[model samples]
Target: MGSTVLDVVNLIIARVNAAWWWASSGSSGPMPL
Candidate 1:
């Protein structure tokens, strides 16, 4: 049960990081197709 909760937290963090990276990349330059 504890491990499952940790897994969920990690997934959320990864998603947030991906979103932040996408936003920063968009502002800095054109995105790839």
Candidate 2:
């Protein structure tokens, strides 16, 4: 149970980081296709 929770938290953190990176990058310039 502890391991499963840790795995889920890691996945969520990774997704949030990706989204943050995208937002910051887009604000700097237009996104590429």
Candidate 3:
């Protein structure tokens, strides 16, 4: 049970980080891309 919860939390964090990276990439200027 605890492992399942931890796995879910890790997945959530990864998704959040990926979303943040995508958003920041879009928001950055062309120089960064």
Candidate 4:
């Protein structure tokens, strides 16, 4: 089945949140945003 727009947005948001959390909690340095 094809993915919906909401699904795409949710995926993007999840990725951003994961990255933010990682940046804050990880020693990888500050977030790119």
Candidate 5:
């Protein structure tokens, strides 16, 4: 049961990291005309 809870927490962290990465990368550069 503890293992399952740890797995869920890890998954949530991974998802949040991925989203933050995407947002940072998307805004780091300027738009092209």
Candidate 6:
């Protein structure tokens, strides 16, 4: 159970970082692009 939660948290962090990087790219309007 603890490991599962930790994995999920890591996944969420990766996704958020990717989205942030994309948004920082000026020409992008939003994420999911």
Best by lDDT: 4
Q: Pull out the clashing pairs in model 5.
A: none
Taken over the whole model, the C-alpha lDDT of each candidate is 0.73, 0.73, 0.72, 0.80, 0.71, 0.78
Summarize candidate 6's per-residue lDDT along 1-33 as a digit string, tens digits: 467988999989999888888878864765752
- TM of each candidate vs. truth: 0.67, 0.68, 0.67, 0.69, 0.68, 0.64
Q: Where is model 1 more than 4 Å wrong at Cα?
A: 1-3, 27-33
Cα displacement (angstroms), candidate 4, residue 6, comes to 0.3
Q: Which stretches of candidate 6 lie over 4 Å from their true place?
A: 1-3, 27-33
lDDT of 2 at 18: 72
Give the clashing pairs for model 3: none
Top-TM-score candidate index: 4
Report model 3's TM-score to 2 decimal places.
0.67
lDDT of 4 at 7: 95
lDDT of 2 at 30: 46
- Give me the runs in candidate 2 sitting further than 4 Å from their true place: 1-3, 27-33
Question: Which lDDT tens digits does candidate 3 get at residues 1-33?
Answer: 467988999988988787778687875643322
How accurate locally is residue 7 in candidate 6, as Cα lDDT from 0 to 100? 97
The local distance difference test score of model 5 is 0.71
Model 3, residue 21: displacement in angstroms? Answer: 0.1
Residue 3 in model 1: lDDT: 73
lDDT of 4 by residue, 1-33 (tens): 689999999989988987878877874765645
- Summed backbone clashes in each candidate are 0, 0, 0, 0, 0, 0
User: Where does candidate 6 clash, by residue pair?
Assistant: none
Better of 1 and 4 by TM-score: 4
